[model samples]
Target: MSPVRQWHDGLQRYGLVVALVALILLLSILSPAFLTVSNLVNVLRQVAVNAILAMGMTVVIIKGGIDLSVGSLLALCGAIAAGLASAGFPVPLSMAIGLVLAVMAGGAQGLLIAYAGLPPFIVTLAGLTVFRGLTLVYTNGSPITGLPDTFLVLGAGELLGIPAPIWVMAMFFASTHFLLRWTALGRALYAIGGNEEAARLSGVPVMRVKVFAYAFSGLASGLAALVLTGRLNSAQPTAGSGFELDAIAATVVGGASLAGGRGNAWGTVLGALIIGILNNGMNLLNVSSFYQLIVKGLVILGALLFDQLVVRRK
Candidate 1:
């Protein structure tokens, strides 16, 4: 490639980095408290789960698939965890069940999409409703509260002076970064997303990889559920509603192609941080919740438009 072309490609690949810096500058200008250590840590804490989920979402989207059930699945898994704890199940055992359920849910969705040949949208859309209903039925439309002390600690407790969730988020990102950067399976994920037919012909395990992606998505949601439940000190049946949109927005804003095969974990991490910072900034500035909704939607649209322009230029 020529020099100009190489420079342009570099800019496109680092679009998320540019956006993140711009957001930080804007927020610092808009809010006097934006750059403080406490607020910065708070922002990181808030973005932890979203970032974790976005990492998993990046994998699926890179494989040219979508998962709309993540939010509902979070609520479902959280509710189950809370219910189990309330019923005297040991905290560790209860969390294990939640993880198993999450993987099973994702596996089922994968089977429907890959082996049964259903569209991913339809399969996961059905899952969205099913899991939402399950959450409500299990909790009887009420929030499940009074989780064991250990359960609360999992979400709200700190490890070595850092929030447990933050630690979990860090480990997940580090591991996923390695997987995406160094493993054959990781390369195959990109290849499958780039072109499934060609990847299959090239000996990629398309079906199994697809299954693993969805399963990981579910596992991420489950982990998020644990953090959320601990933070709230309860599991609201309505918790995590509409969260999938935020995950997708984070992935897209990170420069991941909805068309597939072109993004990185770090970009998604930055994207998730941007979303977290935006929310925190709005709250600090006392932007009305209604207006905040409008602003967020506009920002998402703008990001996609920016991405389109950059892609076209490349």
Candidate 2:
């Protein structure tokens, strides 16, 4: 590749990292509290939920699909888990059931999109509303409380001086990284994303892969719900509202093509960290929450523009 092409590729690949480093530096200079160890750890903890969601989104998007229901699924799963625990179910069993339900929900959507010839966007958008309604109905528009101490540990406890959420994020990211980089299933997803018809003709098991992508997304949302519920020591029916946007933004900022066939677990994590830093820094600087939303919207637009430029160059 020419130097110019290499530079463009680097921008697509390392842009999020550069942005993150620059943001950290700017924030460190602007706010003394930003560089503190406690605050840094807090940032990681805050990003963990979105990072998990974005990793799953990465898989779906790379398969030429999306999952807008992730945020709602998170709420539903958390509420279910909390409700089960409150009703005397074992913490493990409660969590297991919540995850199972989430996966089933996602798989159902995937089957529709893959086999029933439904549009992914429409299916998941409908799911977004359905799951949110289910969450509200399940919790009667209230928060479930009185969760077990062990359940709380998954979100708030520290292991080896690192927050449990961070640990969980790290483990998930590592495993996902391996899957995307070294596994045949990962390659199949990329192929499907690049060209579904071609992938199917090539015997890539396109439908199965699509289903797996959606199922993985649900699994990630379930894990995020666990951490979120634990952190709050309760599950709010309204939780995770608008969280899907953050996950999508993270995936895009991490260099994932919105059109599909691109993205990495590490990139998605970095993107989430960038978002976490932005939110934390803005809060520390007393920036208006409304303005923060505007800023995030602009970031998403910028990422898309960058993706377009790279695509045109290619």
Candidate 3:
């Protein structure tokens, strides 16, 4: 390849990793606390939830689909798990029921998109509202507290001196990486995302794979819920509102193609870290939440523009 072409390819392949390193360095210079151990740990813990959600979002987007209901799914599942446990059900059983509900919700949306010919966006949008409503009904618009210590440990406890949520996030990221890099199902996801019709023609189980992608996304939301609930010591029906946007933003910023068939676990993790660090640094500088939102939006827009101009350009 010519030098220019090689340069462009390198930029596309290594851009996210480079950007994350640059971001960390910039933040460290701007905020003395940015590199402190306690602040770094805080960033890790705070980012764990979004990182987990982004992993799921990465998979769904890779399959040429979007799920706008994951935030609602998180709330509903978290509420169900925390609510039942608080109401005296066995903690483990309550969590399982909540996770099952999450999978069902996602599978239902996937079926609509894959088999019923409904658009993923519309189905998930409806689910966003519907699931939130179900959560309110289940909790009577109240937070669920008094969770058992055993269940809370999943979210709030520490293991190997690291926060539980961070561990959970790491596990999910590793699993996602393994799934995309080393499995037949991973190949199928790419094929379907690259071209659904062609994949079906090639004997890929396109519909089943589609369902699996969304279901996996749902499972991620449920796992995030567990950590979030544990961290807060309660589950609120209103929790996870707008979290879908964060997950999508992180996936896109991490270099995932919105047109599908491209993304990586490391990139998504770095994206989440960048966002988390960005917010943390801004807080250290006392930037207003309003300005933070604008800056963050611009950053995502920049990433999308770069993807279109450099990564996706022929």
Candidate scoring better on lDDT of 2 and 3: 2
Q: Count the backbone clashes (under 3 Å) in each candidate.
A: 0, 0, 0
lDDT string for model 3 (44-66, tens) is: 99999999999999999999999
Question: For each candidate, what TM-score against the reference?
Answer: 0.95, 0.98, 0.97
lDDT for predicted candidate 2 compared with the true structure: 0.93
Tens digits of per-residue lDDT, candidate 2, 161-231, equal 99999999999999899999999999998999899899999999988999999999999999999999999
Compose the digit string of candidate 1's lDDT tens values, residues 1-314.
99988988887777667778898999999998999988998888889889988988888898899999999999999999889998999999999999899989988898888888899999999999999999999999999987888998867899888888788889989988898899998999999989999999999999999998899889988988988898889999999898999999888888788888887788888889888888999999999999988988887888788778877886
Rank by lDDT, highest first.
Answer: 2, 3, 1
What's the CA error at residue 152 for candidate 3, in Å? 1.2
Which 10 successive residues of model 1 have the least lDDT summed?
Answer: 11-20
**What is the model-wide C-alpha lDDT for candidate 3?**
0.91
* Stretches of candidate 2 exceeding 4 Å from the true structure: none
Candidate with better TM-score, 1 vs 3 = 3
Better candidate number, 1 or 3, judged by lDDT: 3
